[model samples]
Target: MTLPFFVYGTLRPGETNHDRFLRGRTSSEEPGRLTGSVLYDGPGYPYAVDEPGGVVHGELVTARPGDYRELLAVLDRLEEYAPGDARNLYERVERGVVRARDGLVMQAWVYVAAPPAAARLRAGGRRIEGGDWRIRS
Candidate 1:
Protein backbone atom coordinates (compact mmCIF):
# COMPACT_ATOMS: atom_id res chain seq x y z
CA MET A 1 0.00 0.00 0.00
CA THR A 2 1.12 3.53 -0.64
CA LEU A 3 1.80 5.78 2.34
CA PRO A 4 1.55 9.52 2.61
CA PHE A 5 4.11 11.67 4.37
CA PHE A 6 3.73 15.32 5.40
CA VAL A 7 7.10 16.95 5.19
CA TYR A 8 7.62 20.52 6.42
CA GLY A 9 11.36 20.81 6.43
CA THR A 10 14.29 19.31 4.62
CA LEU A 11 12.30 16.64 2.87
CA ARG A 12 10.25 19.01 0.75
CA PRO A 13 11.07 19.29 -2.96
CA GLY A 14 14.17 21.37 -3.79
CA GLU A 15 15.32 21.01 -0.19
CA THR A 16 18.59 19.33 0.63
CA ASN A 17 17.19 16.04 1.81
CA HIS A 18 14.46 15.70 -0.79
CA ASP A 19 16.73 14.61 -3.62
CA ARG A 20 18.67 12.35 -1.31
CA PHE A 21 15.59 10.52 -0.08
CA LEU A 22 12.45 11.14 -2.12
CA ARG A 23 13.30 12.57 -5.54
CA GLY A 24 12.03 9.76 -7.72
CA ARG A 25 10.57 7.52 -5.07
CA THR A 26 7.31 9.31 -4.56
CA SER A 27 4.25 8.70 -6.72
CA SER A 28 2.78 12.16 -6.22
CA GLU A 29 3.40 15.38 -4.32
CA GLU A 30 1.54 18.59 -3.60
CA PRO A 31 1.70 21.55 -1.30
CA GLY A 32 0.17 20.76 2.06
CA ARG A 33 -0.36 22.25 5.49
CA LEU A 34 -0.35 20.78 8.96
CA THR A 35 -2.65 22.63 11.26
CA GLY A 36 -2.22 23.05 15.00
CA SER A 37 1.53 22.90 14.93
CA VAL A 38 4.40 25.36 15.21
CA LEU A 39 7.70 25.37 13.37
CA TYR A 40 10.94 26.29 15.08
CA ASP A 41 14.42 26.72 13.74
CA GLY A 42 16.78 23.96 14.72
CA PRO A 43 19.81 25.69 13.23
CA GLY A 44 20.53 23.72 10.07
CA TYR A 45 17.05 22.21 10.21
CA PRO A 46 13.61 22.86 11.69
CA TYR A 47 11.25 21.05 14.04
CA ALA A 48 7.50 21.10 14.45
CA VAL A 49 5.52 20.98 17.68
CA ASP A 50 1.84 20.61 18.43
CA GLU A 51 0.11 23.88 19.16
CA PRO A 52 -3.46 25.10 19.41
CA GLY A 53 -3.57 27.66 16.60
CA GLY A 54 -0.56 26.84 14.49
CA VAL A 55 -0.26 25.93 10.84
CA VAL A 56 2.83 24.60 9.14
CA HIS A 57 3.28 24.87 5.39
CA GLY A 58 4.74 21.80 3.76
CA GLU A 59 4.30 19.15 1.12
CA LEU A 60 2.45 15.88 1.09
CA VAL A 61 4.11 13.05 -0.74
CA THR A 62 2.88 9.57 -1.55
CA ALA A 63 5.37 6.75 -1.53
CA ARG A 64 4.68 3.68 -3.63
CA PRO A 65 4.20 0.34 -1.89
CA GLY A 66 7.53 -0.97 -3.07
CA ASP A 67 9.31 2.11 -1.76
CA TYR A 68 7.43 2.67 1.48
CA ARG A 69 9.48 0.55 3.84
CA GLU A 70 12.81 1.67 2.52
CA LEU A 71 11.76 5.27 2.45
CA LEU A 72 10.41 5.13 5.98
CA ALA A 73 13.56 3.44 7.19
CA VAL A 74 15.74 6.12 5.69
CA LEU A 75 13.55 8.87 7.10
CA ASP A 76 13.56 7.28 10.52
CA ARG A 77 17.32 7.19 10.49
CA LEU A 78 17.56 10.73 9.25
CA GLU A 79 15.21 11.92 11.96
CA GLU A 80 17.12 9.94 14.56
CA TYR A 81 14.04 8.03 15.55
CA ALA A 82 14.34 4.44 16.68
CA PRO A 83 11.15 2.88 17.93
CA GLY A 84 10.94 3.06 21.72
CA ASP A 85 14.21 4.89 21.97
CA ALA A 86 14.18 7.44 24.76
CA ARG A 87 16.70 9.64 23.05
CA ASN A 88 14.91 9.92 19.77
CA LEU A 89 15.11 13.46 18.42
CA TYR A 90 11.72 13.38 16.84
CA GLU A 91 8.59 11.25 17.19
CA ARG A 92 6.91 10.14 14.01
CA VAL A 93 3.13 10.23 14.17
CA GLU A 94 0.13 10.20 11.87
CA ARG A 95 -1.62 13.52 11.49
CA GLY A 96 -3.95 15.35 9.17
CA VAL A 97 -2.52 17.33 6.29
CA VAL A 98 -4.55 19.65 4.06
CA ARG A 99 -3.51 19.97 0.45
CA ALA A 100 -2.87 23.58 -0.41
CA ARG A 101 -4.34 23.47 -3.88
CA ASP A 102 -7.63 21.68 -3.28
CA GLY A 103 -8.06 21.68 0.49
CA LEU A 104 -8.10 17.90 0.52
CA VAL A 105 -7.32 16.58 3.95
CA MET A 106 -5.56 13.28 4.56
CA GLN A 107 -3.68 11.48 7.25
CA ALA A 108 0.07 11.32 6.82
CA TRP A 109 3.18 10.56 8.80
CA VAL A 110 4.69 13.67 10.49
CA TYR A 111 7.63 14.12 12.76
CA VAL A 112 6.89 16.16 15.87
CA ALA A 113 8.89 17.16 18.85
CA ALA A 114 8.21 15.37 22.10
CA PRO A 115 7.13 17.43 25.13
CA PRO A 116 10.60 17.88 26.54
CA ALA A 117 12.07 18.54 23.16
CA ALA A 118 9.34 21.02 22.41
CA ALA A 119 10.01 22.85 25.63
CA ARG A 120 13.71 23.01 24.88
CA LEU A 121 13.16 24.17 21.36
CA ARG A 122 10.68 26.74 22.46
CA ALA A 123 13.18 28.07 24.91
CA GLY A 124 16.04 28.37 22.45
CA GLY A 125 14.80 27.98 18.91
CA ARG A 126 13.54 30.88 16.88
CA ARG A 127 9.92 30.46 16.00
CA ILE A 128 9.21 30.58 12.28
CA GLU A 129 5.95 32.53 12.43
CA GLY A 130 5.09 31.87 8.82
CA GLY A 131 5.66 28.14 9.34
CA ASP A 132 7.71 27.78 6.19
CA TRP A 133 11.24 26.57 6.74
CA ARG A 134 12.56 28.06 3.52
CA ILE A 135 11.66 31.52 4.72
CA ARG A 136 13.60 31.25 7.93
CA SER A 137 14.86 34.53 9.48
Candidate 2:
Protein backbone atom coordinates (compact mmCIF):
# COMPACT_ATOMS: atom_id res chain seq x y z
CA MET A 1 0.00 0.00 0.00
CA THR A 2 1.16 3.51 -0.73
CA LEU A 3 1.87 6.02 2.01
CA PRO A 4 0.73 9.57 2.34
CA PHE A 5 3.34 12.25 2.95
CA PHE A 6 3.33 15.90 3.90
CA VAL A 7 5.99 17.89 2.05
CA TYR A 8 6.71 21.41 3.35
CA GLY A 9 10.00 22.30 1.78
CA THR A 10 11.85 21.66 -1.46
CA LEU A 11 9.94 18.49 -2.14
CA ARG A 12 6.71 20.40 -2.60
CA PRO A 13 5.51 20.95 -6.15
CA GLY A 14 6.93 24.04 -7.91
CA GLU A 15 9.91 23.83 -5.61
CA THR A 16 13.43 23.08 -6.78
CA ASN A 17 13.63 19.34 -6.16
CA HIS A 18 10.09 18.50 -7.17
CA ASP A 19 10.66 17.78 -10.84
CA ARG A 20 13.59 15.47 -10.25
CA PHE A 21 12.05 13.30 -7.53
CA LEU A 22 8.33 13.80 -7.21
CA ARG A 23 7.13 14.97 -10.62
CA GLY A 24 5.64 11.94 -12.34
CA ARG A 25 5.73 9.61 -9.39
CA THR A 26 3.44 11.65 -7.15
CA SER A 27 -0.15 10.44 -7.34
CA SER A 28 -1.91 13.47 -5.88
CA GLU A 29 -0.91 16.70 -4.17
CA GLU A 30 -3.15 19.20 -2.47
CA PRO A 31 -2.97 21.85 0.21
CA GLY A 32 -2.68 20.30 3.63
CA ARG A 33 -2.05 21.71 7.09
CA LEU A 34 -0.10 20.27 9.96
CA THR A 35 -0.16 22.13 13.24
CA GLY A 36 2.22 22.54 16.15
CA SER A 37 5.39 22.95 14.07
CA VAL A 38 7.78 25.73 13.28
CA LEU A 39 9.76 26.66 10.16
CA TYR A 40 13.37 27.75 10.24
CA ASP A 41 15.77 28.43 7.40
CA GLY A 42 19.30 27.29 7.97
CA PRO A 43 22.44 27.89 5.91
CA GLY A 44 21.10 25.79 3.05
CA TYR A 45 17.33 25.30 3.19
CA PRO A 46 14.26 25.67 5.35
CA TYR A 47 13.18 23.16 7.98
CA ALA A 48 9.89 22.54 9.72
CA VAL A 49 10.92 22.34 13.33
CA ASP A 50 8.42 21.22 15.95
CA GLU A 51 7.08 23.87 18.31
CA PRO A 52 3.92 24.95 20.07
CA GLY A 53 1.38 27.11 18.24
CA GLY A 54 3.16 26.41 14.98
CA VAL A 55 1.60 25.29 11.77
CA VAL A 56 3.37 24.18 8.60
CA HIS A 57 2.13 25.00 5.15
CA GLY A 58 2.70 22.22 2.66
CA GLU A 59 1.19 19.66 0.32
CA LEU A 60 -0.19 16.18 0.85
CA VAL A 61 1.15 13.58 -1.52
CA THR A 62 0.22 9.93 -1.93
CA ALA A 63 3.02 7.81 -3.36
CA ARG A 64 4.39 4.33 -3.30
CA PRO A 65 6.42 3.39 -0.25
CA GLY A 66 9.48 2.88 -2.41
CA ASP A 67 9.04 6.32 -3.81
CA TYR A 68 9.05 7.71 -0.29
CA ARG A 69 12.23 5.82 0.46
CA GLU A 70 13.84 7.09 -2.71
CA LEU A 71 12.76 10.57 -1.77
CA LEU A 72 14.25 10.12 1.71
CA ALA A 73 17.60 9.10 0.22
CA VAL A 74 17.61 12.18 -1.92
CA LEU A 75 16.82 14.36 1.09
CA ASP A 76 19.59 12.69 3.04
CA ARG A 77 22.09 13.35 0.27
CA LEU A 78 21.00 16.95 0.20
CA GLU A 79 21.32 17.12 4.00
CA GLU A 80 17.58 17.55 4.32
CA TYR A 81 16.85 14.42 6.33
CA ALA A 82 18.33 14.17 9.83
CA PRO A 83 16.76 11.03 11.18
CA GLY A 84 18.55 9.45 14.20
CA ASP A 85 22.18 10.58 14.44
CA ALA A 86 22.59 10.98 10.70
CA ARG A 87 23.11 14.78 10.82
CA ASN A 88 20.58 15.30 8.06
CA LEU A 89 18.87 18.60 7.44
CA TYR A 90 15.32 17.40 7.98
CA GLU A 91 14.33 14.69 10.42
CA ARG A 92 11.68 12.24 9.30
CA VAL A 93 8.64 12.47 11.56
CA GLU A 94 5.08 11.29 11.74
CA ARG A 95 2.48 13.99 12.09
CA GLY A 96 -1.26 14.52 11.77
CA VAL A 97 -2.40 16.00 8.48
CA VAL A 98 -5.71 17.79 7.96
CA ARG A 99 -7.37 17.33 4.59
CA ALA A 100 -9.21 20.28 3.15
CA ARG A 101 -12.70 19.05 2.39
CA ASP A 102 -13.72 16.88 5.29
CA GLY A 103 -11.20 18.09 7.87
CA LEU A 104 -10.20 14.54 8.51
CA VAL A 105 -6.99 13.57 10.28
CA MET A 106 -4.49 11.29 8.58
CA GLN A 107 -1.14 9.98 9.64
CA ALA A 108 1.63 11.09 7.32
CA TRP A 109 5.37 11.53 7.10
CA VAL A 110 6.94 14.92 7.72
CA TYR A 111 10.49 16.21 8.04
CA VAL A 112 11.54 18.46 10.91
CA ALA A 113 14.92 19.77 11.99
CA ALA A 114 16.71 18.93 15.17
CA PRO A 115 16.26 21.44 17.96
CA PRO A 116 19.95 22.30 18.32
CA ALA A 117 20.32 22.83 14.61
CA ALA A 118 17.15 24.83 14.35
CA ALA A 119 18.22 27.20 17.10
CA ARG A 120 21.03 28.51 14.95
CA LEU A 121 18.54 29.72 12.35
CA ARG A 122 15.66 30.70 14.56
CA ALA A 123 15.49 34.40 13.94
CA GLY A 124 11.99 34.77 15.26
CA GLY A 125 9.06 32.72 13.99
CA ARG A 126 6.78 32.30 11.00
CA ARG A 127 3.01 32.16 11.00
CA ILE A 128 0.66 31.32 8.14
CA GLU A 129 -2.91 32.23 8.56
CA GLY A 130 -5.48 29.70 7.27
CA GLY A 131 -2.70 27.40 5.97
CA ASP A 132 -0.82 29.30 3.29
CA TRP A 133 2.90 29.85 2.57
CA ARG A 134 3.03 31.61 -0.76
CA ILE A 135 5.29 34.64 -0.49
CA ARG A 136 3.29 37.74 -1.09
CA SER A 137 4.47 40.91 -2.71
Candidate 3:
Protein backbone atom coordinates (compact mmCIF):
# COMPACT_ATOMS: atom_id res chain seq x y z
CA MET A 1 0.00 0.00 0.00
CA THR A 2 1.15 3.52 -0.73
CA LEU A 3 0.60 4.86 2.72
CA PRO A 4 1.90 8.08 4.20
CA PHE A 5 5.14 7.99 6.20
CA PHE A 6 5.56 8.49 9.95
CA VAL A 7 8.87 10.24 10.46
CA TYR A 8 10.23 10.99 13.93
CA GLY A 9 13.83 11.92 13.41
CA THR A 10 16.01 13.59 10.81
CA LEU A 11 13.31 13.56 8.19
CA ARG A 12 10.91 15.74 10.16
CA PRO A 13 10.57 19.34 9.02
CA GLY A 14 13.62 21.52 9.81
CA GLU A 15 15.74 18.47 10.65
CA THR A 16 18.97 17.76 8.81
CA ASN A 17 17.65 15.16 6.37
CA HIS A 18 14.38 16.93 5.66
CA ASP A 19 15.73 19.21 2.97
CA ARG A 20 17.93 16.55 1.48
CA PHE A 21 15.33 13.81 1.23
CA LEU A 22 11.85 15.17 1.68
CA ARG A 23 11.85 18.77 0.57
CA GLY A 24 9.30 19.66 -2.09
CA ARG A 25 8.20 16.06 -2.20
CA THR A 26 5.31 16.11 0.18
CA SER A 27 1.88 17.64 -0.10
CA SER A 28 1.04 17.35 3.57
CA GLU A 29 3.07 17.04 6.71
CA GLU A 30 1.22 16.93 9.98
CA PRO A 31 2.26 16.26 13.54
CA GLY A 32 1.46 12.80 14.78
CA ARG A 33 2.22 10.36 17.55
CA LEU A 34 3.05 6.70 17.24
CA THR A 35 2.06 4.62 20.17
CA GLY A 36 3.79 1.34 20.94
CA SER A 37 7.24 2.65 20.07
CA VAL A 38 10.09 4.24 21.99
CA LEU A 39 12.86 6.41 20.59
CA TYR A 40 16.46 5.34 21.13
CA ASP A 41 19.71 7.12 20.36
CA GLY A 42 21.59 5.97 17.30
CA PRO A 43 24.88 7.16 15.81
CA GLY A 44 23.58 10.58 14.85
CA TYR A 45 19.92 9.88 14.32
CA PRO A 46 17.29 8.31 16.51
CA TYR A 47 15.69 4.92 16.13
CA ALA A 48 12.11 4.14 16.94
CA VAL A 49 12.03 0.82 18.75
CA ASP A 50 8.65 -0.91 18.82
CA GLU A 51 7.77 -1.46 22.40
CA PRO A 52 4.32 -1.70 23.94
CA GLY A 53 2.86 1.36 25.72
CA GLY A 54 5.46 3.77 24.40
CA VAL A 55 4.68 6.92 22.44
CA VAL A 56 6.92 8.52 19.83
CA HIS A 57 6.39 12.00 18.47
CA GLY A 58 6.69 12.56 14.73
CA GLU A 59 4.96 13.74 11.58
CA LEU A 60 2.71 12.01 9.11
CA VAL A 61 4.01 12.88 5.68
CA THR A 62 1.98 12.44 2.52
CA ALA A 63 4.04 12.37 -0.63
CA ARG A 64 2.99 14.15 -3.76
CA PRO A 65 1.58 11.81 -6.39
CA GLY A 66 4.51 12.32 -8.74
CA ASP A 67 7.08 11.83 -6.03
CA TYR A 68 5.81 8.76 -4.21
CA ARG A 69 7.67 5.99 -5.96
CA GLU A 70 10.98 7.77 -6.19
CA LEU A 71 10.78 8.99 -2.62
CA LEU A 72 9.98 5.52 -1.36
CA ALA A 73 12.97 4.01 -3.11
CA VAL A 74 15.28 6.78 -1.94
CA LEU A 75 14.13 6.53 1.66
CA ASP A 76 14.47 2.76 1.66
CA ARG A 77 18.02 3.09 0.46
CA LEU A 78 18.76 5.82 2.98
CA GLU A 79 17.39 3.72 5.79
CA GLU A 80 19.40 0.67 4.67
CA TYR A 81 16.31 -1.47 4.34
CA ALA A 82 15.92 -4.47 2.07
CA PRO A 83 13.20 -6.94 2.70
CA GLY A 84 14.48 -9.79 4.90
CA ASP A 85 18.02 -8.41 4.94
CA ALA A 86 19.89 -9.20 8.08
CA ARG A 87 22.09 -6.18 7.59
CA ASN A 88 19.28 -3.69 7.77
CA LEU A 89 19.33 -1.04 10.45
CA TYR A 90 15.65 -0.26 10.08
CA GLU A 91 12.60 -2.03 8.73
CA ARG A 92 9.72 -0.16 7.21
CA VAL A 93 6.50 -1.27 8.76
CA GLU A 94 2.86 -0.20 8.63
CA ARG A 95 1.53 1.16 11.88
CA GLY A 96 -1.24 3.35 13.18
CA VAL A 97 -0.29 6.86 14.16
CA VAL A 98 -2.52 9.38 15.84
CA ARG A 99 -2.73 12.63 14.00
CA ALA A 100 -2.19 15.51 16.35
CA ARG A 101 -4.63 17.71 14.54
CA ASP A 102 -7.68 15.53 15.07
CA GLY A 103 -6.83 12.67 17.36
CA LEU A 104 -7.66 10.31 14.55
CA VAL A 105 -5.56 7.22 13.96
CA MET A 106 -4.25 6.51 10.52
CA GLN A 107 -2.05 3.84 9.04
CA ALA A 108 1.35 5.00 7.87
CA TRP A 109 4.76 3.59 7.06
CA VAL A 110 7.21 3.78 9.94
CA TYR A 111 10.88 2.86 9.94
CA VAL A 112 11.44 1.03 13.15
CA ALA A 113 14.68 -0.44 14.42
CA ALA A 114 15.54 -3.76 12.84
CA PRO A 115 15.79 -6.86 14.97
CA PRO A 116 19.46 -6.60 15.92
CA ALA A 117 19.29 -2.91 16.54
CA ALA A 118 16.04 -3.22 18.37
CA ALA A 119 17.50 -5.87 20.60
CA ARG A 120 20.53 -3.77 21.36
CA LEU A 121 18.39 -0.73 22.10
CA ARG A 122 16.12 -2.71 24.34
CA ALA A 123 19.06 -4.13 26.21
CA GLY A 124 21.12 -1.04 26.93
CA GLY A 125 20.77 1.93 24.62
CA ARG A 126 19.92 5.36 25.94
CA ARG A 127 16.30 6.21 25.29
CA ILE A 128 15.13 9.70 24.52
CA GLU A 129 12.93 10.86 27.34
CA GLY A 130 9.33 11.65 26.57
CA GLY A 131 9.81 9.88 23.23
CA ASP A 132 10.65 13.04 21.34
CA TRP A 133 13.84 12.76 19.31
CA ARG A 134 14.27 16.50 18.91
CA ILE A 135 14.37 17.16 22.64
CA ARG A 136 17.19 14.75 23.31
CA SER A 137 20.47 16.25 24.50
Candidate 4:
Protein backbone atom coordinates (compact mmCIF):
# COMPACT_ATOMS: atom_id res chain seq x y z
CA MET A 1 0.00 0.00 0.00
CA THR A 2 1.15 3.54 -0.64
CA LEU A 3 1.93 5.46 2.50
CA PRO A 4 1.87 9.13 3.32
CA PHE A 5 4.50 10.70 5.56
CA PHE A 6 4.45 13.98 7.42
CA VAL A 7 7.85 15.60 7.58
CA TYR A 8 8.55 18.69 9.68
CA GLY A 9 12.28 19.03 9.54
CA THR A 10 15.19 18.51 7.14
CA LEU A 11 13.12 16.07 5.16
CA ARG A 12 10.76 18.80 4.00
CA PRO A 13 10.95 20.22 0.47
CA GLY A 14 13.86 22.50 -0.44
CA GLU A 15 15.71 21.40 2.67
CA THR A 16 19.19 19.91 2.64
CA ASN A 17 18.06 16.32 2.76
CA HIS A 18 15.10 16.65 0.45
CA ASP A 19 17.05 16.25 -2.74
CA ARG A 20 18.97 13.28 -1.48
CA PHE A 21 15.91 11.51 -0.15
CA LEU A 22 12.51 12.57 -1.36
CA ARG A 23 12.83 14.75 -4.46
CA GLY A 24 11.72 12.55 -7.32
CA ARG A 25 10.58 9.63 -5.25
CA THR A 26 7.37 11.07 -3.91
CA SER A 27 4.22 10.82 -5.96
CA SER A 28 2.59 13.86 -4.38
CA GLU A 29 3.41 16.53 -1.85
CA GLU A 30 1.49 19.24 -0.09
CA PRO A 31 1.88 21.64 2.82
CA GLY A 32 0.32 20.20 5.92
CA ARG A 33 0.06 20.67 9.64
CA LEU A 34 0.04 18.38 12.62
CA THR A 35 -1.71 19.72 15.66
CA GLY A 36 -0.69 19.13 19.25
CA SER A 37 3.04 19.14 18.55
CA VAL A 38 5.90 21.57 19.00
CA LEU A 39 9.06 22.00 16.95
CA TYR A 40 12.46 22.28 18.62
CA ASP A 41 15.96 22.96 17.42
CA GLY A 42 18.04 19.84 17.62
CA PRO A 43 21.17 21.77 16.75
CA GLY A 44 21.65 20.99 13.04
CA TYR A 45 18.16 19.57 12.71
CA PRO A 46 14.72 19.93 14.25
CA TYR A 47 12.63 17.61 16.34
CA ALA A 48 8.93 17.49 17.01
CA VAL A 49 7.25 16.45 20.21
CA ASP A 50 3.72 16.27 21.45
CA GLU A 51 2.43 19.46 23.05
CA PRO A 52 -1.19 19.98 23.91
CA GLY A 53 -1.57 23.40 22.36
CA GLY A 54 1.08 23.29 19.68
CA VAL A 55 0.86 23.08 15.93
CA VAL A 56 3.69 21.91 13.69
CA HIS A 57 3.94 23.08 10.10
CA GLY A 58 5.28 20.56 7.65
CA GLU A 59 4.60 18.70 4.44
CA LEU A 60 2.68 15.59 3.65
CA VAL A 61 4.24 13.37 0.98
CA THR A 62 2.81 10.34 -0.70
CA ALA A 63 5.26 7.59 -1.61
CA ARG A 64 4.52 5.30 -4.48
CA PRO A 65 3.98 1.70 -3.55
CA GLY A 66 7.15 0.68 -5.35
CA ASP A 67 9.19 3.14 -3.30
CA TYR A 68 7.50 2.87 0.07
CA ARG A 69 9.66 0.27 1.76
CA GLU A 70 12.96 1.67 0.58
CA LEU A 71 11.93 5.22 1.32
CA LEU A 72 10.95 4.37 4.85
CA ALA A 73 14.21 2.53 5.43
CA VAL A 74 16.22 5.54 4.40
CA LEU A 75 14.16 7.85 6.58
CA ASP A 76 14.43 5.51 9.53
CA ARG A 77 18.19 5.51 9.26
CA LEU A 78 18.29 9.28 8.98
CA GLU A 79 16.13 9.68 12.05
CA GLU A 80 18.11 7.05 13.94
CA TYR A 81 15.00 5.04 14.53
CA ALA A 82 15.58 1.36 15.12
CA PRO A 83 12.65 -0.85 15.72
CA GLY A 84 12.61 -2.40 19.21
CA ASP A 85 15.38 -0.13 20.33
CA ALA A 86 14.77 1.36 23.77
CA ARG A 87 17.09 4.28 23.15
CA ASN A 88 15.78 5.38 19.79
CA LEU A 89 15.95 9.07 19.11
CA TYR A 90 12.55 9.18 17.46
CA GLU A 91 9.52 6.97 17.48
CA ARG A 92 7.61 6.54 14.25
CA VAL A 93 3.86 6.68 14.57
CA GLU A 94 0.77 7.22 12.47
CA ARG A 95 -0.99 10.52 13.00
CA GLY A 96 -3.54 12.74 11.33
CA VAL A 97 -2.26 15.59 9.18
CA VAL A 98 -4.34 18.45 7.83
CA ARG A 99 -3.45 19.78 4.43
CA ALA A 100 -2.73 23.47 4.56
CA ARG A 101 -4.11 24.21 1.11
CA ASP A 102 -7.36 22.44 1.87
CA GLY A 103 -9.19 21.03 4.88
CA LEU A 104 -8.45 17.44 3.99
CA VAL A 105 -7.24 15.25 6.82
CA MET A 106 -5.26 12.06 6.34
CA GLN A 107 -3.28 9.64 8.43
CA ALA A 108 0.45 9.72 7.81
CA TRP A 109 3.57 8.37 9.39
CA VAL A 110 5.31 10.88 11.63
CA TYR A 111 8.47 10.71 13.65
CA VAL A 112 8.09 12.18 17.09
CA ALA A 113 10.68 12.52 19.78
CA ALA A 114 10.56 9.68 22.21
CA PRO A 115 9.53 10.44 25.80
CA PRO A 116 13.06 10.63 27.15
CA ALA A 117 14.30 12.42 24.05
CA ALA A 118 11.45 14.87 24.26
CA ALA A 119 12.25 15.65 27.87
CA ARG A 120 15.87 16.29 27.00
CA LEU A 121 14.98 18.49 24.05
CA ARG A 122 12.42 20.39 26.11
CA ALA A 123 15.05 21.17 28.69
CA GLY A 124 17.80 22.21 26.30
CA GLY A 125 16.61 22.73 22.74
CA ARG A 126 15.23 26.05 21.66
CA ARG A 127 11.55 25.82 20.90
CA ILE A 128 10.38 27.22 17.56
CA GLU A 129 7.16 28.87 18.60
CA GLY A 130 6.06 29.17 15.01
CA GLY A 131 6.60 25.48 14.46
CA ASP A 132 8.32 25.96 11.15
CA TRP A 133 11.92 24.86 10.84
CA ARG A 134 12.40 26.81 7.62
CA ILE A 135 11.73 30.08 9.39
CA ARG A 136 14.67 31.69 11.09
CA SER A 137 14.53 34.59 13.45
Best by TM-score: 3
* TM-score list, all predictions: 0.94, 0.77, 0.98, 0.94
Q: For residues 40-133, could you state the per-residue lDDT of candidate 3 as single tens digits?
A: 9999999999889999999999999989998999999999899999899999999999999999999999999998999999899999989998
The TM-score obtained by model 2 is 0.77
Candidate 4 residue-wise lDDT, 1-137, digit = tens: 35599999898898999999998789998999999999988878888999998999999999876888999999999999998799998999899899988778989999999889899988887898899999945
Better of 2 and 4 by TM-score: 4
Model 3 scores a TM of 0.98
Q: Of the pair 3 and 4, which is ahead by lDDT?
A: 3
| Cα RMSD (angstroms) for every candidate in the order listed | 1.3, 3.1, 0.7, 1.2
Model 1, residue 97: distance off in Å is 0.6
User: 125, model 1: CA deviation in Å?
Assistant: 1.9
Residues 56-78 of candidate 2 have per-residue lDDT tens digits of 77888887545766755665566
Clashes of 3: 0
Per-candidate total of colliding backbone pairs: 0, 3, 0, 0
Q: What TM-score would you give candidate 1 relative to the actual structure? A: 0.94
Q: Give lDDT for model 2.
A: 0.68
Q: Provide the lDDT at 53 for model 2.
A: 83
